[model samples]
Target chain A: MKFKAFLTDNGISLLEKRFLPALDKMGKICHLYLTRDHAFFLHNLLNGDGIQSIAQFRKEALFDDYRISSQNEDRIAFAVDLSLLHRALRSVVTIYAEFGADGGAAAVPPSNRLQIKLVKKLPPHSQQAMPFLTFETKGYKSAVIQDVPISKPLSRTDVLELQAALDSAQDLPQTLVQVPDMNQLQTFVDRMKHVGDPISMSISKCGDLHLQISTTLITLGAEFRKLLVIGEKAQVPAEDRNLTAQSRSERAILRGDAMSVQVSVKHFSKSLQCHLAKPDCAFYGIAPQGACLTVIFQFFIPGTHQTDKSISLHCRLPVLDPGSG
Target chain B: MSSEVDAESADLECELDNVQGMVDALSSVRWKRHQDAVIELSEHGIVLVVEESSCVQAKVYLQKELFVRYEYSAQARVRFGVSLGLFVDSLNTFSRPAHSSTIEIRYPGPDMQLLLRSVDSLDACIYAEIRTRIPETISWDYNFEPAGSTPLSFTVKSAALKEAIDDLEWPGSSIQVSLQPAPPVVTFRGEGHGDLQIDFMYYANTDLLTAFHCDREESHRYKYKFLRATTSNIPSSVIKENRGSKLTIGRGGMLKVQHLVSVAKQSNSHSHADSAGYLQPSRIAYIEFFVKPEVDDDNAND
Candidate 1:
């Protein structure tokens, strides 16, 4: 298996500064799935709730130039510690900052590509060996190589099951609402984070969103109006598009017909921390009957037309049992 | 002794219009745990000294100019040891920006409790009393004067310093800092999983350093953990003021970092006779951290 990519400084910065930090908060280890067209950082997020968050960096969105050659046609996956990779990227960025971008030393020739190589190395006197991901950049006379060890990839059954879940989730009737900005959403969630457990969120057909938390003593909530509704054309399948169109006309009379989801306040707030990286636009997707909720953040490289780079955090919250609580 | 005790009973009381100015300064040294901080109150100002492990000490001084009313009895000074955490929390209770709070601090005598009362504009008041004990007088003579004719001194933009430090690869337990005069280079070196060296040359990047002076080449290795006590404060300091902070290194390997606290303008103005004539641009608080270099026997000769 071989994978090499010429990643731009901006692309690397987004992953190091924005993408990885959010993943670090969710889980320790993640499977980095590298295909011909994309690099996926898949985290199970076993935050005790068994939620999964996938950060998909399309090849066009990540690398200025790249290539991936593997024996099999399927994507090659490997597990790596998110924190370790973050540190490695930080080190690489630091080197670039200190020594001019061309690599500070005069002996090494300048190269545009920050090469990443995965190699299996057997150290001296070691009985077992594992693969290590090495980040190397050569400039003028200076060169830096940061090697981070990787763990065995997740089981094929687990990967397939996760993919199936994502695929099945797309067909669920979702109420998509455009979040005005991350700051406002973060503030609303932050205030409710400490109020109580199992925050209840409802998005009306008229584009009004309400977040509320109630305890035995107090019930606190906030209402946000005029939230933009994401049309069904983009997300709904072609056959179901007509059905949604028909329902839209009928739902106009029933303004309060809203989709609602109840999720743990602690887990909900932890997911909001990812917004600190500052995504350009965010969308909230709630599954019907309060099954699950998804937050999709869109990020783009500055001065670039590539807008496909995005991260979606999927939270699996149990439908609040009426008698259990 | 009886007259002295009577005089102490009538000691001075301190009052300020805003508690945020005091809380912001104390939060910088909140890293120390279970350590008693001595608060010295006088007519001139209030001084808070926090000592940790007998090796590192931090002092935050709020001058009388920053306070609205400063009064003192006939006594010279009143010093007491209080829990820094509790004191800081009491001040922080009224730290909201929207509400204006007036803080009154009073000490009756040696064994009397320290009373801190905060009253907000909404007629809400919070009263907190902390038991005060006689502060242990430890004579710590820190000579600000340099041992050599010209000590290593430089003023760099806080943003640049913070960025440079954040960018350094902290690979080892200690970081080696080198300041040289000939080439005017400031380099930091660390070793752990790998050897990492970062250098800043005056000629290369002139914008980062405003002033650089060194008589001879001086390099010292300090415990990275100790130096980290001030790392988190750098970003906040730079955000407050564009003007950089000053760093001074003495021959004894002691490092002094001075940060000017940014004071928010008072929205509610009281035209008192005392502060009416004082037309200072703004109140400024200074936080100084003094870190003693760890002795590395291997590098002692070098």
Candidate 2:
């Protein structure tokens, strides 16, 4: 396997300030998947019990002059500690900040650019060759290089399994509804954690979501209605469609049955950490079999409706048995 | 915020519009986990008192005047016991990121629970009902009296006061708080591995000491643990909005620390009933703590 890329100034910032830091909060180690089109950080996607996070970035969006080649169609996947990668990018960003006035063109000088590559190194205390994701930043009078050790490249079969997991994770529910404001959700979850271990999240067909946490003493809940549903309206069963035929507001209030799934409050709390990403809006959906609660964070162009497709984050919170709590 | 609503609300409901302020007030007194607190409702307002041992006690006074809507329907005072930590956490949920929260809090909920409901979410609502039990007998009710005719009081910045107590870190010992009349200064001395003395200059450092008054020089010793507990969790939001906290030497060397919590959002602070005040003092809620001093031979002079 081979991979090399020069990270653009904007790319360095996006990683240093947003994605890497976000991943750092989610977990200690993450899978770095480099392909022809994008670089993805996959967390807890395999051997999971914790939160599963996927942060994807288009190649040109983060790096220029990108190249990757492998025996298996130019794709490489390996696990690396997030803190190490975060430090590497942060150091370069700080150095560039000091010499910010040195650039005049559409980008920084070639010598000042940050480059990352996959390399094998022999440590001073060990004889075995170890794979490293190397970061090199060369300035006019200074050059800084860091080699962060990473797990061995995935085998062909491992790659295929990861591909299948990615496909399954990307599958969205037929109906997607925007969640309550993160601040409210944050406080709601805070209250719920004290009431019970697992919470029941119910989303009705008429765009109403209710989260209830119960204990022997009391049952606490927050109910959100008239939320905006995103994209295509999923096909509804004939009986449900007929039920939604009343006036919109009345129908929303009248609907009582909803698709509900029980999820661990610990996992729910971890997913709330996505607020650090500063998503413009977030949507909540339930995976098939009530297996996972999926949260998609949508980032939009600051002043317009244009979705900034360069970056994306998806979190899957595993569901817990209803009887567990 | 309208007179019509207030006139109507006073007859039978106890609702409030500032959930953030209530949370901030409650969080300041939540020094320990699972602390039982007494909530008393009267014609004047709500009083929440949390006591640690018989030596340390904290109280939050949510005057009816501070509430957006205050209604006292019960013919007699009502009291209930709740977990301070849980109450604060539950109040937090009603707050929204972009807007201040409005909530209606009522006692004697259908099942004798404390009911809290959010009123600000356009098409959404959040509510929490916490189980309330009968108030247990407390050992003491400390009614603070003046140490001297002038009350021997001084006001200092809340954040600075908290920092000073935190710096005196001599564990399992006593913190001696002394006032000097000659120079108008206050000193906190902690004795352990090495002696640490933190002095506040009332005459020179007028900025830190907003006000200073002492009839005579006096000194007192208090448990280091109890002294620190009083200022342990002054909320960050409180530090930003208010000016300072007041420290008074009460009867028998009892220390009283008072902090003003701005319950009214600054931009729209025009009370339904207009009034003039310092830093909108009338609109602010009050938090007070009475700490009984450790009797190290009455004259705790170094």
Candidate 3:
């Protein structure tokens, strides 16, 4: 199996500036799954927290050339230390910032190509070695190559499970809530972090959103009215599609009825950190009566009105028991 | 408990065009060792006091006239203690440099929670309700009256004092502030690694020192950490249209630093003169930091 890609400067900067910080919070080890269509970086935290995070980069927007060859039908997956990768990316960004496109080298033209190659190497004594991610570029004076050591690829079963989760989440019963402004919600969650553990969010059919956090000393809540709730539009199985339509219409009938879910305030706030990127528009994909919450931040290329790219952060928090505080 | 509270609950509310000004002031003192603060609401205005390590205290006073609308119960004073971190975080959510957010605060009654609503330039509103507890009544009877006929007091530009404080050498536990009347000079002495002294002669730099008064040579040593907490507000105050920071050395070795901060003015009200039109910023908001001197046995005789 092999995977290679030429990443764009904007794509690499976004990964370094926005995505890496959130991934760092999940775990140090991550699996990079690359395919012709997309590239996914997954981190399943082993801190006994069962926390998993993934960042998906679309092939067209992220890379100039994407290629993958594998014996199996699925994409190729390799595990590597994300911290080391982040450090390498930071150095690349620093060099790019210090020396612009030209770098004042007329003899040797500066290359925008940050070529990434994954290949297997054999050591002096070892019969075989895992694939290493090698980053190379031709600078003004000379060529520089950096090698990042990789670990054993994720087990086939683990990769399948992650892919299944991502696929299943697409057809789940979801209500899209447009976040007109994130500052208020950000502040509300920030304050709730200090006083409570589990935060309950309730969205009514009338587009009223309520976030409540209760402790022994205080029970605070903020109500947001008139948030647009787009009905489920994703393709679902024939039978489930009918059921989803019926439930959505029923919700429309009861204006005050709301679907509420309780999530760890800390985890939810961590997911909200994507707002730091200042995306043009933000929306939440909340599964009905489920602990899984997906926050998608959409960013458009400057000078263009198209929003064809986005970074989605998913969070699965424990549901609080009704009897517990 | 008071009958007037019932009447006030019906219509008691205060509004401000901008919330960033107060957030900046509170942040200056929020870094102290105290995690909580007491907010006292009276007919005069709102007073937030943060007491740190039982040795230092900072108070930000927003007078009644500072608010676009101020209403208080005529019966009794309303006071409560809240987590300073939470309060500051909630207020900061609406703070942006490009645009100022409007804030409306209401204290309905003793039983009801305090309500705060902030609306940003985009018309995004954040409504926060903070629970309050009865503030602990502490005896703060430090007399600030000068001991002699002439008090050791001076008015200095906030930017100048902030720069001097920032330039002081670290690893020093105490900052010795000395005031002299003969030549009108103010000196800051930090004794760490070596003795570092910074003096501002009133005669040499008249623009730096706006006013100076001293009867005798008096010097007081205060914990450098406590004094450092007050310097954070200097930068914000110095950028205001009307900016000046006053330092007064009161009796019992109490240090008081005061700044008059200009808050948001009404966008439509542009008079520029007393008789030309309606005036903006009818009153000024001031934040003061009070620090108690440390009693050092080594310097007691000196």
Candidate 4:
């Protein structure tokens, strides 16, 4: 006989105080997904943060074979953010769980034991079926599981054609690889595998291995890291929510004549400096706090005689403000 | 002998050369009309003659001073009278002639010394001596301060001008001016040894018939002022009449002609001025001449 466990008000209160805080401190919380099996499994490991964890939980729930076999139908629900699925390879794996949208369904017994198996496989770069895994495994129920199937035409064919042309060109462009001396390194680890063996490859001048290998490793490692990230569910920290501030100072006019201008500066870093034309008047002035700095000067009008009457002076204040970060 | 020839040529050049009078003199040579002090060149020297309307000549010699003070404490007065000695000296030396030239003149100005001079040679010679003496008291007592961090600047200012003109009491003549083949246009061309020369005739007006002789028979004076003439669209023919005409041929009506051989033979219209019943003005253009009897040497010296 199947039993029912109703969460009492007192139980709920206790859970909020105890479990919720624990989840908050760990930076991750548990998620519930509906399944035809009406059973649940504790799947996908996560650090305290709930962001990266929920992704893993959704994948596990979607590909659970026991649930698929028990119900012999499609009953999978989509995760909140599908971008988390950017890290899958060959076929997606999942763990099944049970959930009831109605009270009557809750009366059923929990589904089979928790298991992991490939629920669906995807073609190479088959973007049309993205976020939806479609397959024809005999033991399974439906071949597809997703909130919505993709409706746009996939660009994989065009990409393949372009790639072919690129590959056959005689003077194929190549990216040179820069290798660094790795003998001195104590430890190096990469979640993604590329050209070099993970164990003995040397670091290059760019602190990387061969170009293609390094690029692939970086790309794949980013995806793996993303998958790991999605496994967690969390809220933003106080530090992140804090407001950042930036400021700017005023400009002061120093001197002006028929042909040139001198500006006074108080306090600034690289943004504030004199700009003058070449081959005109040479400038020397002061900067920072006190008077005396290098002045940038140029001839106001070229080839005009050096006579005072021939000179003209112009002065303008530049906008001085720190841009928003 | 070529040097002698060149010297002779130089003398001939001196006689024929167009003398440029003082900077501010009779703007145009007019007969029977008297200017204040018309600077003129003579075989003797540069002269500034005083006529009936001689107020400007006296005003120009006062160093542009409105008044003067005897002492720093004294009130500046309207100087009604002031004496200044103006004399000519040799260009080679700053020495004045034994006898100083002086004239009694009145004006509303300050009492100050003014000097003037003239040179014999035109091209290289300066027209007049320009001199000013900074008094020892104020010479080094002041300094200038520039607007910014720049140093001060100093400049010396002076002018060259005529002190007097030849006697201006000569009698008025009936000066008649007209343009031949009047109006629309008159064109001429001329060539000198060096640069090209052009002459044009502008209009003229006069009050010659209104002149009256001064009561003093010995004095060359009149109770009249010279009237100014207005000019517009001046033509060369009028210029030729105004100044006596010179050698310049002008072709007004058109004519055509052709030169060179045509192997197969071709016909063409000849466009020569004479053949076309038209006359071309001589290449050397307009000139203006008017009778101006020489002032008596003794009267001019006076």
Candidate 5:
């Protein structure tokens, strides 16, 4: 496999400031899934005990003059230490901010360009070779290169497992609703931390959401009524029109019944860390059978409702046992 | 408790046009260590009180006039206990930062819960039912009588007062708060590893002290931790409203700090007049903190 790409100034800012800081709060390590057209950061995708997070970015939105070739469909997936990667990216961003982007607008000078490549760093002590994601940035008269160690590329089976996980991450229920205010949800979740650990998040088809925590001292709840129901129209299959017509009657029955999932407050709060991205809007939805709760963060064109599809974030928090309720 | 059939008309119900206004008011008294608070609703409004170790007590007064619609038909005052932090958090969930959501608050759910519902959201309804329990008797209600005939009292900018206390945080465990009549100034002195003193001197051009009163020179020592509790929770929003906090040395050197929290819609939206041509957005919440002075330390200082 051979991979090399030059990151745009916009890409450096987005990764260095918004995405990395958000992922840094969730965990130490995440799988970087890179394809010919896109780059995705998969956090805990193959369930452990943490909230599963997937952040996707269109390759064109980030890189320029990109090239990659691999034995497996031009795709590569490997584990990366988020902190290490963030530190490396931040240094490049710092150098650019100090010297590069300001004076030159049209074209990046030869020295100021940021080049990223996949290289093998053969440790002298061991015969086995290790791969690293290398970042090189030049500023003023000085140049800095950072190589972040990465896990070995996933085999075909492992790639298939990750693909399956990504497919399921899209399995959010159709009853997703636009949350009222992020500040409100954040403070509510933060305050409930005092009462108990496991919080029951119930979202109904009627757009009612109740977040509750009960302890011996108090059974506290916050209900949001009449929230705007939102759904991703692109995900629905055209051939499922008959299924949609049939489920319409079933949806009427589901309107009165709220699907409740018990999740650890830590996991729920961890997902809220996406707030750092300053998303234009955030939606809350529950998966079928209360399997997981999905939170989608989207960016919009500042003055208009048009969604900026270049970046997206999805968090699926696993539901704990229902015995607590 | 499910007996009230005409609950909407007979219950203690109130409407707040600005939910963040209420959040800002309650957040002024929220400290991380304290959670349990007593919420009492009467014809006047809601009074939320949280106490720490029976030494530092904070009370938030949401006047009935603050609410756009206040309906209190319950013959007896309704009182309940709730997690102050959780209540503030839940209230937050119902509000959108960009727009003020009209929130309707009602007490005594069928199961003795406090119900909060957002009324302005026609397509989306946001509500929370906070479980309420019988309120415990408040640890000691001070008579708040005048300390002496002259009555030691002073009004200073709340932000300045909080800053003075916060700045003294690094020096020692206890702080000596002294107000002398001759100079018309209030001083906070912290002594330990190093001594730090912050003073608010009343002058014509400065806005520090708006009002002042004193009987001779009064000095009292208060635990730095307890003093911090009184000011740490004063949400910055309240300070932006530009209000004064009054420090009254009540009977026996008990210090009472009073802060005003504007519950009105931000001035940008406050101009909307109701049908009565009387919907005044001049609502203000009264928050008072009473911290008992360290009595033995006072004797030692004397």
Candidate 6:
């Protein structure tokens, strides 16, 4: 059964208005995983003390936790586990947040301030500048700033502090840390080491397609925001190579594509673009201003003169870019 | 026969698609040159194709609090270029404080003996991108006064005063600031014994404005700097909009205060619902002119 696109309340409107069309144009996705945490912040905002709820997510909580904070100003942190996505299932392994939580029920009036952060996996050697995540409310259109990570390699003290904090539920944001689970690492390594034939099969056979993700956000100056993700890797096959491995285990030497994604939004209302490191490796196309897009890719047997596999599909959905005219 | 036609069309389309992809990649990857473009958000580290002829540098600064946290405050410098045209144009067009710019420190201190050349220029108009590794907590206030003296003297009543001062209490005595003729000098002449953080200044010669921001936990005093004639010649607008005037500490915000000055022989009268000329003077008072601490939480967009 195909997994229907499930968008939480907060993220529902955007998906219907923009992202749905983009996904439809791509057409390869058998199942799309719109997350629940995306809507949690808005729910908290409606409840009261929404900002506080978001602030809690900024602390050490589960990746699925909804958080908001208004102590300083209303802020929200929304995370998604792309590993649940059907297309990514066979490629990636575990994907989740380090820590996250709901800010509980609102204890005060709701603030009108709004902020958003989008995080996904990115490998090294990726472009630094990021595309903007733009949105609109009435006449007000704003883009949340994008912050790049300044790699803070964890120190031994940091590890110890995190271990202690995890053992005891105290000093969350400061002490809470997410180390790669050994089992998860081993699974990923094992997959990388196993050589597989080109993943060309009947559409029904591909297993869990998910996008693994992790992100941390920081607002630098008033004019900028930074979203930092650590150790992101998305692998794609190279061109001009025919996969003829007799067994799936024989093709261990092939290297998958590594992508670094940077999304930057300037001012509240301006152009937002994502700069990918290796443009050639990216088969995916981005719409201008991320307008409603229609993508069609024709495929055939790599080096064959025969015609056996044929599939045609069509989908329509809105695009994300509130500032676009 | 029909199948052959289909294959031919498919081959043609694939070839055309490959060529189109090459052209599209070239156009799509055109790099935009950015010297100090304001960071709108946080993503990953930056990577641009560095040209051998073009000198490229990226400089990002945080509020002093954040800079100190990153331990880069001492090393942080304005990104400069070897390109002469860019440098001269920068000095001319971008010299003054713009709406979204910051006023940064140009010198270390009196001891540093440094010039504005080494000082950091702050952008008062634009908020800096900031990320804090520490807990952020902050509050705000602004001083208000008429641009110039009018028929009506602004009063410091309880309510109007509340917005300017946090948790204020009547000093229980009179406070008078005398502007003596020491070549256009304005001193923080006060009599009250309390720890205070006062932002005192002169505006439109008829208002000796001393906005007292109180923190009972710490002893504070309101201090004024005596501006020389040469310095006073510069409009109060320039001073209020001083580049260094804006600083982001933890979470960022904008604050304001009114400028009031009293003309010679013209005493500005005041009453706390009771008309009495009693200036409250502190026994242990310290005064100095300094920039208000700015808490910058601009890291949201990095």
Candidate 3, residue A8: lDDT: 75
Residue-by-residue lDDT tens digits, candidate 4, B1-302: 01112122111012101111111112222222222222222222222222222211111211111111111111332221111111211111221122111111111112121212122222111111122232222111112122223211111010000000011112232111111323211112212223221222222211211111111111121121221111111222222222221111112101100001001101135422222111212111111111111234454412
Q: What value does DockQ give for candidate 2?
A: 0.32
The candidate maximizing TM-score is 2
Ten contiguous residues with the weakest lDDT in model 3 chain A: A240-249
Give all candidates' CA lDDT scores: 0.64, 0.77, 0.66, 0.20, 0.78, 0.20
Q: What is the lDDT of candidate 2?
A: 0.77
The top-ranked prediction according to lDDT is 5
lDDT of 3 by residue, A179-251 (tens): 7677756665775676666877655544555566666545555555556767743232243222222233234
- In CAPRI terms, model 3 is classed as incorrect
**Which candidate do you rate higher for DockQ, 1 or 3?**
3
Instruction: Compose the digit string of candidate 3's lDDT tens values, residues B147-185.
Output: 567777998888788777876747487889999988889
- Poorly placed runs, candidate 1 (over 4 Å): A45-48, A96-112, A123-125, A169-173, A232-256, A300-325, B1-302
Query: What CAPRI grade goes to candidate 4?
Result: incorrect
DockQ in order: 0.01, 0.32, 0.16, 0.00, 0.22, 0.07
lDDT of 5 by residue, A1-325 (tens): 8789999878887888888999988889999888899999999987666889999999987899889889889988899999999999888766655564566555456556888999998766988889999998877656788899999989988988998889878776777877888866786677667667798777766565667676654455566656777752222233422221213213323443456778999998888888887788888887876778889988886688999888889898888965211
Alpha-carbon runs more than 4 Å astray in model 4: A1-325, B1-302
Between prediction 1 and prediction 5, the one with superior lDDT is 5
If the candidates were sorted by their lDDT against the true structure, best first, what order would they fall in? 5, 2, 3, 1, 6, 4
lDDT of 6 by residue, B123-232 (tens): 11111111112211211112222222221112222222222233222331222222222222222223456433333332433233322222111111222211110122
TM-score of chain B of each: 0.83, 0.88, 0.84, 0.17, 0.90, 0.16
Per DockQ, the best of the predicted structures is: 2
What's the distance in Å from true for residue B186, model 4? 13
Instruction: Write model 2 residue lDDT over A160-196, tens digit each, in one string.
Output: 8887888778988655789868866776687678766
| Model with the higher DockQ, candidate 3 or 5 | 5
Reproduced native contacts, each prediction: 0.00, 0.58, 0.20, 0.00, 0.33, 0.20
lDDT score, candidate 6: 0.20
| TM-score of chain A in every predicted structure | 0.78, 0.87, 0.78, 0.16, 0.87, 0.15
